[model samples]
Target: MPVTSAALLLHHGRGADAHVLIAHMGGPFWARKDERAWSIPKGVVEPGEDVEAAARREFAEELGVPAPDLPVRDLGPFRYTSGKVVHVLAVEVPAALVGSPDDPASPDLTTRPGTSTAQVEWPPRSGRRIDVPEVDRAVWFALPRARPLLVLGQQPVLDALVAATTP
Candidate 1:
């Protein structure tokens, strides 16, 4: 059976004005990519671990900060082409936690260095291993803007979020 993953979709605002927090994948492969290179902060769920807990854990690990203590709504699971089922939870963070989307250098959006790292084979199958930050940076983007930036497989989570949040 494929491993089940979980993700935390952090957003602020409502309806057409909503924005979501997404992370740019780290390492050489993703270095020059922009569109389809970002993803919601996510990770594998440990056996017997609560899905929501794992989502929050991944958010902290990937972003290098604790997820805001806000009520999270389960947006449910989305299946990736790789067969991994990522359970998604959505949280509406305060403006203080999001800062200004126009300013990428906003302190609230900045992640501390050295908190998130991943081991990867640099030149695919070359047996050369390298350590890279799991996520180079995180940014807040309005819903429409975030759509094209997110990985194709995970785009549905945005739809799920809209459906779950819309009246």
Candidate 2:
């Protein structure tokens, strides 16, 4: 079976004013990149884990903060061209949880210091290894503004969010 993952798309507001939380992928490869360098908080679904539970767990792990206890709208599963299937769920978070789109420096969306980390071969095949945070920082961006910044494979997940919340 293809690998399955789950994500939680955290958004605030509605319509054109809506903003979603996205993390800047950590490590050297993504450090200097902006476009297509951000992603929804997600991870693989462990064996026998409930999809929703996995999404929530991944959100907390990646952000280093527990997700708010709120109802979520299922955005369903999206299969990327690489054959990875990601189950996405979205919740409208409190306005206070998201930083102002006009103020990138606002601390509202900052991740805690103890966020999850991953080990990788620093030079890609080199003998050196380094541990880096899974996501260095997270912020809020308007829906349209977030499109170009997201990983191509996950752009569809954003689309699903738009459709589900459009009404």
- Residue-wise lDDT of candidate 2 within 15-110, one digit each (tens)? 557789888888888879999999899999999999889999998888787777889999999888889998988888778754433322223233
Listed in order, each prediction's TM-score against the native is 0.90, 0.89
The worst-scoring run of ten residues by lDDT in candidate 2 lies at 101-110
Clashes of each: 0, 0
- In the order shown, the candidates' Cα RMSDs to the true structure are 3.0, 3.3
lDDT of 1 by residue, 92-151 (tens): 877665454332222232247535788999799999999888888888899899999999
Off by over 4 Å in 2: 99-111
Per-residue error (Å), model 2, residue 158: 1.9
Model 1 TM-score? 0.90
Clashing pairs in 2: none
